[model samples]
Target: MRVVSLVPSLTEAVALTRPEVLVGATDWCTHPAGLDVARVGGSKYPDLARVLALRPDLVLLNEEENRRADADALLAAGVPVRVTFPRTVPEALTELADLAGALGATAEPDWLVAARRAWAALPEPGALRRAVVPVWRRPWVVLGSRTFAGDVLRRLGVANLYAEDAERYPRPDLAELRARRPELVVLPDEPYRFTADDGPESFPGVPCALVSGRHLTWYGPSLAEAPALLAAQLAQPG
Candidate 1:
């Protein structure tokens, strides 16, 4: 079956599992290095015409990454669209299994199996360290409650300072974040591209760790390596 994926992580998952099935993907889907699929557009603003032109049997979308308008348009055009919302590691695993099933593919890929095992083997966070994780820098948007990234960090013994906030992604003032007096600040390099030089200096007294956004945010094969990778980054002297 031909598939078009708007979510980068899901694009990678489908491409790596069965490349032939993916006929089109968003411009942001940059994994599997040499993917030769038709580029639709960005996750937020997908080119509906281009996507439909691919004549895909299924279009994949993420509830967080994709816009509702695009999904509605596709549905109106008689295009089948599958939207997934996985806010935790287990949820991600289940989503992958379900997606694979929909594509007539095996869910027991090596990476999928390893990811499940890795997350399952993790010990509970005994004493959590309070941390403020920034996903964007300019407006200062942070990972808030009920987010996949927050759940990931919580599993690694780091509690998000704004996890109890009302908004899932809150744009708090720098002064407010500092007032929280978090033990560490976790920075991811996507949606904002926070670097060691750019992000760390903002928090003078607080320690900071620059992490891969893919591992921290993406829910795909990356999960296999994320647990250990994030742990190592969080352990760094920052």
Candidate 2:
């Protein structure tokens, strides 16, 4: 079965299914090393004609990455598209199982059990303080409540100040953050890397920590590695 992955995690999923099943991937779909193939531009803004030309039997997408119109057009053209939104660890495992079933591969990884154990075993925090996490740098978007990233922070006993009013990632006015007065702010190295020292000056009076976006944001197998990293941060007294 020829498969095309437009989502980054699905690209990693395709890699887990073994290289032979993957026929095409978007430019951002690099994960499992050494499995280079075709690149289709940005996952959300893919060239529809070029994608159709690939003649893939199946294409993968994420609600966050792929636009609805594009998915609709592809479906209209009779190209099957599998959409996924992996929020919690269980959801992520489910998505992986669905992809494996789609690929007709039986071997699977049980990541949830390990994740729960690690989650439950989180070290007692030296201090529980509120923090704001910025995922993007330019407009200064943050990881608010009801999202995977927000939930993860909650698990760590860190309160999310914007949980009540903001969206998953909302660009609030500078006054809002100042009013909230978070104990320490966290900026991730992701779509835009915010170094610990570089942009903290923009939002003064709040001590900040530059964090690994993949660990804090990426909601799949990556979560297994997140706790260890977070533990180090929690160890530091506020």
Off by over 4 Å in 1: none
lDDT of each: 0.91, 0.73
**lDDT tens digits, residues 1-238, model 2?**
7788888767766776556878788887657677687777888788878788888899888888789998999999999999988666556666777677778876565453455567767766555678877677556677765776676777677777877754677897666777778887876677678775566886776677666777776655566668878656644522
Mark the 10 consecutive residues where model 2 has the least summed lDDT.
Answer: 107-116
lDDT of candidate 1 over 1-238, digit per residue (tens): 8999999999999987887899999999989799999999899999999999999899999898999999999999999999999988889999998887888875467778899999999998899999999999778999998999999999999999999999999999899999999999999989789887898999998889889899999999999999999999999937
- Give the Å error, residue 137, model 2: 3.5
* CA shift of 231, model 1, Å: 0.5
TM-score of the candidate numbered 2? 0.85
Kindly state the number of residue pairs that clash in model 1: 0
Residue 191 lDDT in candidate 1 = 76
lDDT of 1: 0.91
